[model samples]
Target: MSKEAIVARIEKKPLSMTINGKKIGPIDVPVGMPMIDFLHHYLNLTGTHFGCGEGVCHACTVVEVKSDGSMVDTRTCIANAHSFDGKTIITIEGQAKTDASGNVTQLTPIQTAFIEKFSFQCGYCTSGFIAGATAFIDRLKREPVKRADLETAIEEALNDHICRCTGYVRYYEAVRDVALATPGCVIGQEDKR
Candidate 1:
């Protein structure tokens, strides 16, 4: 096929989604374009880092809040932009509250814990860590884990993320601290007994 014909065959679709509590698009996006590109190039929501481009590193993770109000971490590197149609997603940008002037007024406990614990070095993977940890914490709110299982749960939830800076200890520790501090994230000792 000729280059012109192939170029003409490229498909475009209208994409729309709720991102970070804000409605975005009805914008035309090329089919098969990665969600990461849509976020960075079209919307300029660059906090979702495109690390490793292949979805293995998971530095491009975002939280997709399902219709049932459960959140799942989604990797944007390989997922098509069209796949997120009408979905509600939260990027790293949405983790904190901002004042009317757009200045951040409060950080989510997970975010504050990550900072207080110094959970990252280069910070490239920090967004993914935050998204994953936040979702895990939210899940705990709905289904509290046994106190004894908290550590293993933390490890399981965050184990897939690859941090080149070797900040795993701090990251895991931060999440553990948040889980313990947040009421209902872990079952009470009395309940365990």
Candidate 2:
């Protein structure tokens, strides 16, 4: 039940799998290696930005599936390399591609919405927000959301990423706009004061 004991028990194992459609893990890597290092150094998925390595900034947030079939956010900066044994993950790079059908493929509606609305200032947090919010919006699509409800949802979705460039308003606006613009989940036009 101790960290040293557990690590010593599995010191010689490696992990590998498909990430954003590319194969990773199943290869030899050091025990307790951080996922961020593997992503940025080995596989080159730079879209997963890192703001704070302590997991408080949420900038490195990526979606991965748990064994229970539940999707959750994990901080790549501190996540152990071997923890990703057999799970599917979606990172910022995964959302940047499009399809040959000319339908704006991999970039989710929420990401497109962020671009259309200029939802970022320094742009450091956009990737995290995009990945996090798109997943949130996808779930919202399964239900009904109104204008006010949309604002609350966007606010809740981006409660982590810190923006010192004073672009928070625009970021929130962009997400709300995307949710509303999305068919069947629209927030009414903002009231001009």
Screening candidate 1 with a backbone cut-off below 3 angstroms (N, C-alpha, C), the clashing residue pairs are none
- On the 0 to 100 scale, the lDDT of residue 44 in model 1 is 89
lDDT of 1 by residue, 30-138 (tens): 9999999999999989999999988899899999999999998999999999999999999999889998898999999999999999999999999999999989998
**Span of 10 residues, lowest total lDDT, candidate 2:** 184-193
Q: In candidate 2, which residue ranges exceed 4 Å CA deviation?
A: 1-12, 65-71, 98-106, 184-193
lDDT of 2 by residue, 1-193 (tens): 9999886777556787668766675787777778888788778778788788888887888877555545566778888877887767878777667575634456666677777777787788777777677666665666556665766776777787777676778778777666666676553545421
RMSD vs true structure, all candidates: 2.9, 5.6
Instruction: lDDT for model 2, please.
Output: 0.72
What local lDDT score does residue 139 receive in model 2, on the 0 to 100 scale? 59
Q: lDDT score, residue 83, model 1?
A: 98
